[model samples]
Target: MTWILVLVAIGLLSAVLLLRTRRTRQKNEPPLDKGIFPWLGHALEFGKDAAKFLTKMKDKHGDIFTVCVAGNYVTVLLDSNCYDAVLTDTKSFDLTRYSQLLMDRIFNLHLPNHDPVSERKRVNQYFNSSNLSRLCSTMRNNLQFLIASADTQNPTEWKKDTLFDFCYSLLFKAGYQTMFSTENDNTAKFTDVYEEFRRFDKILPKLARRAAARDELKFASSARKRLWELLSPNCFLTGSVTQSWMQTYLQHLKEQGLDTETQRRAMLLQLWVTQGNAGPAAFWLLGFLLTHPEALKAVKAELCSLQHLPLDKTEDTPVLNSVLKETLRLRAAALITRDVMQDKTIKLSNGQEFVLRKGDRLCIFPFLSPQMDPQIHHEPEKFKFDRFLNSDETMFCKEGLQMKYGTMPWGAGSNLCPGRDFAVCALKQVVHMILTQFDLELCDCNASMPPVDANRYGFGMLQPDGDLKVRYKLKKHN
Candidate 1:
């Protein structure tokens, strides 16, 4: 009877503690949509359509709110007014934790907790202004070789092809050759490794599940193993090819005392980073130009002006530059995320402030926020080719404000992409080659713009849901 009495008292104490904890949470935390599930929370709703779901939430909950996704409360900042607070307060907010989580979950790679400052500095040097300028000719030559070898080079007849596939193939081949391998490297071997990489990339979102399932993990492991074989120092020790990015990175990893397996995984991560955005961006730029006749004509006129001029002066092609910028604004879907390292108050431009708790993630949806603001971008949904260009040959502004963070395709602040200049140069070179070498048109003029792949929202530029059919023939210049 004494033991029974003790158990009853313990149960009553537990109930009281639970109620007190709930009350404290209700008072301190931002409004969280727990959804219907016990712990799954908003995962289903978010996975179904992230952009639409977030938009609906923004309408109901204002700019700042929390959603319980997969048992974590993700605080989203959906207004450009709050961007400065996130960008400037690096001490309170950090990107490394979020990046590490993504690499661990999606890419199946584990990284060290410490900062890789030296490694980052070395990588940045490779993509500096001088190196990027020197690489322009290399990029152009690669594109030229691919185009000349393609079956579409026959000027006598138009060749039909899918835009995404064509762009992916061209960009992948050119980028891989230029950045990852030496001139004398075996093309067939590199192509095999690249194909495997694509397979792994396609299943990244499902990586956790696949890793648990034996059959799926088997395929993924085989692909990774083969990639390791190609990138390992043993294979390249005697090769005549000059050191590429991967080789240099491998040397760094060895100096840092990482095992071969870990080094290979790091190389894989680098490969994904280098190739992720450029291909999709190229596809959208060319695809949009093909579908919009007036825009195409204007850009073509701009291209004609550059006939006698040097291709090295990419900035001189104002119309093409504007088109690329506008495309980035329209299509790039990046989730700029930072972890709240300590409890802090964020001051907003609208004279409001919010308290962020430690261990919380502060996320900025670039697509749903500044990029789509009607005030910032008039007719935000429409593709205005020259929307970014001002009368004085500068970036457009909103409400007499310069709008520095209005459209962040390569992101902002310290975490901005190191390879932004290289990427832009490569993209410009690709478009230049296509415009100067090929006569291109959409096979179906009435085709609508393909839907963005919602699954890829936070993974750089979203790919089209379906490929656009296009026809091309060699352009005959007198």
Candidate 2:
């Protein structure tokens, strides 16, 4: 029995060593699967320019290529043909694995058990189509308050301020209002938390955030416990409309006997999604707008036509909607990630076979693919706001659906963003406010549209690297 145990251990060690050697050999041999780098195994190459790196590889190695990640081979499919298979094909791939990693590291929760489908449904309930009016009103009130606060706090500096910062302020305020029912007027409190989160997110040498991730639970736990105390059935600030809607879900669960850990997780998830993407979206929109003057003008025109109130919006404004779509195509956030759930073979139309084994990462860099595709738009580099605006809605839909690359701003497939509607509504209101109130132009003489260093995570959904300093003059009518 002892001899057998020794043999088993030896066999496991042999397998690990063999896998490591095989991966190392694959790294040095070019064109076995193109984009294979020396020593670094495509890591260093990709680390430099994540956005266009894959596209560049595809230009050299066809559409299919493999890279060694954490000592495993990850095959990246470049075009739209396999997008459906990789992203939407649940039998083959799943986002839960990647989502779980992020949720655990960033939000300190178990995501697979969290029932993303059910959570999405619940979130859908919160942003239901019928409740569009209410949501819009909530968003508008939030927008007005954010803008007014910015104006009040920094009237003169507001013009010279970076649009990216403005985007952060807007997203933070909206998220605070939506989840907490209070505008994030506490800049110090908000900035401290946000900066801390951002600092933690950066995985740098000697700066680990594992402890900080634990602290998220600690913070949520304390907040939930305090809320329970402040409002035991009948409450003052607790009964406020904003607090009720935001906190009711958890409050109801507590009444029904939820465990402390479970309740803490639920609250954290609620807070995470509301705040995570808002700031990034704002930065991207402002960055794109700063670069593309014509696009910004069209967006402003659309906003002017649709806006009835100074702070709010009317139904869908087409031009503004198009501008938002185009901007997202140019800059969306949260890198689209998926996990290989099974030993799946991806068969290419060209008769190439690639095997994606279980536990491998399937990431789509839509930021690079969507905006740079020549077939998708005329003059891919130039910002044409109406590129997505087709005369026939059906044709537009087909054109959009057929785009294999450069089209995945919010990602594609089943897990495509559930919060897209809310994001669009919020962005439209913010852009409308900015355009209606201020005449904006790029103040940074050196910068152009889609500023460089946009791609950080080697995914296309990168926001501009720095704050977009824009010249803002009060509109003549305003």
Error of 1 at 188 (Å): 1.3
lDDT of each: 0.74, 0.58
Instruction: Please provide, for model 2 over 178-223, each residue's C-alpha lDDT reduced to its tens digit, 9 standing for 90 to 100.
Output: 6554332355545544554444333311111232334655654454
lDDT at position 141, candidate 1: 80
Q: After the best TM-score superposition of candidate 1, give how far the Cα of residue 106 lies from its true spot, in angstroms.
A: 2.8
* Alpha-carbon TM-score of each model against the true structure: 0.87, 0.74
Task: Return the top candidate by TM-score.
Answer: 1
lDDT of 1 by residue, 201-223 (tens): 66564563222356766766777
Q: Kindly report the root-mean-square deviation of model 1 from the true structure over all alpha carbons.
A: 4.7
